[model samples]
Target: MKSLKITIALLLTAMLLACAGNDELDGLTADSGEQQMYDQAQRYLRNRNFSLAVRGLQLLESRYPFGRYAEQAQLELIYAHYGAYEHEAAVEAADRFIRLHPQHPSVDYAYYMKGLAAYAGNTDLFARFLPTDVSSRDTTHAREAFAEFSQLVSRFPGSPYAADAKARMVYLRNLLARHEITVANYYFRRGAYLAAANRGRYVVENFQRTPAVADGLAVMAQGYIMLGMNDLARDATDILALNFPDYPALDDDGNLSSDYSLEEGQQRSWLNRATFGLFDPPEIPQFDTREQYE
Candidate 1:
């Protein structure tokens, strides 16, 4: 009974919303011709009234599906959604346009806008104002954006947006590598040495040429050392020496350095000292690569 009542309530609400939307469209395009409606939408776009522009464009497209300006209106709707910060909506609109008009001359623009929307959605408003590390956040949208941009570049190398897409792809690739390194750092902190080493190896193998590659090597070396995998640690250190000789975690001899060393003559706490540090043993300093990013 309760579920039926809820369903009925939802249906009535949807009907009311549909009626309200129709009423709004009727009022906005009362006696306006197709061109006049399009002009009104353009005015909204020019004035930066994105929400109104989206509404007007949507109405115009629905009222005149066969009108000369129908295709243009669909394209503008995508931009209006983007301008209004409805990134997901913008991506959906772009997809619809591409599917409907695959051979459209401006299809490259739609692809570019789709990728841009996903990229913008990933960063969001909070990330702009906050001190959060983007690499530590969920990477779903970032991966999506990268894939979309990659598609744009692959399918339309001559596109005006190709260069910018390529640039963004580079950043996204680095960001992804950094995320892997960040996870490895976390695993190291938690004493999951094997897990950390695997993460570092994954980054090195998959995210070549990224800035985080150096950090990945550093983490791998440290994790292997912690796990008593001396041979693997030496291999990682040798690679680090050849590639990133000046990495902060390495010393003059290219060996891992303990940055967590105690100051000279600094003693343990009274309880620890009395227990000869058996109860609270000093932690071995782990090689941390996070300092570079910080």
Candidate 2:
């Protein structure tokens, strides 16, 4: 009985979608042809009815591939998909527009929209309110977003969107740097000294000037100490002290302090240990983070 009900519900949804599509098609039957459909889509978009806008735009494109409204319809489809939070569809539409009209003046906007969609695609409703570290999560969309933004800035320096694209690239670069630092911290805490130190070196080399570089150096020094490489550890510590004198990991002698130890992380209060950190919550690692988005 439950299975039958679910099947019936799915059939109803399909039928409703078919009917909606027909209604949009029927509305475009006026003698004005492509203009009528395009106008209808514009109205839906202005009213923020993205679903209807998407349907109308899709119809306009299919029915008038070479019509005067075809190019505009394709561009609007990208915006419609983005507003509806269909990020993949938005990116695909943007790519299609750019491919078909590479030299068009508005192609820059398409590239910008693609990058924006990819970035927002990584955002979740809850994370908007809570303090979440997006970099520590899956980086596929973040990397994609970064690449798109970089392309826009490199190809269209004087374009109005280029400045904003550059700003977003900064944010994305810092996020990637912080991700590597976080991973290195995990290896450090787990006593995998070589793994931890390599991650720290990667951040310093690949993501220079980001705020996370200080922590990366700290991780590198600590990892080297655990592996009994005193000279290397001292070198990392000295550079960190020179660049970030106020860094918390520095001691009075300007050497890396021994505070970031697995022992410190494991020494929980008796109350927390008995309750498995329920009574006294285990401390999440803290890093000096930088936020450029205002």
TM-scores, each model vs. reference: 0.80, 0.80
**What does the lDDT read for residue 252 in candidate 1?**
84
lDDT per model vs. reference: 0.81, 0.79
Candidate 2 residue lDDT tens string, 1-294: 686687678768966874675465444653447888998999888977787788889888888999998999999999999987788899999999999999988999999999999988887754654578686787778899999999999899999999999999998998888888777765543445688789889988898888888878877887777677889988998998898887775788888654553343353556765764456543424444444211
Candidate 1: residue pairs that collide: none
N/CA/C clash count, model 1: 0
Model 1 TM-score, all chains together: 0.80
Error of 2 at 78 (Å): 0.8
Please give the lDDT score at residue 231 for candidate 2.
93
Off by over 4 Å in 1: 1-27, 260-294
Summarize candidate 1's per-residue lDDT along 1-294 as a digit string, tens digits.
686687678768956764554445434764578988998899878977777788899889888998999999999999999997899999999999999999999999999999989988876653654478888888888899999999999999999999999999999999898898878766654555689899899989999988888888887887787777889989998998899888887788888775522331232345555664455433445444556643
The CA root-mean-square deviation of candidate 1, after full C-alpha superposition on the true structure, stands at 9.7
Compute the lDDT for candidate 2: 0.79
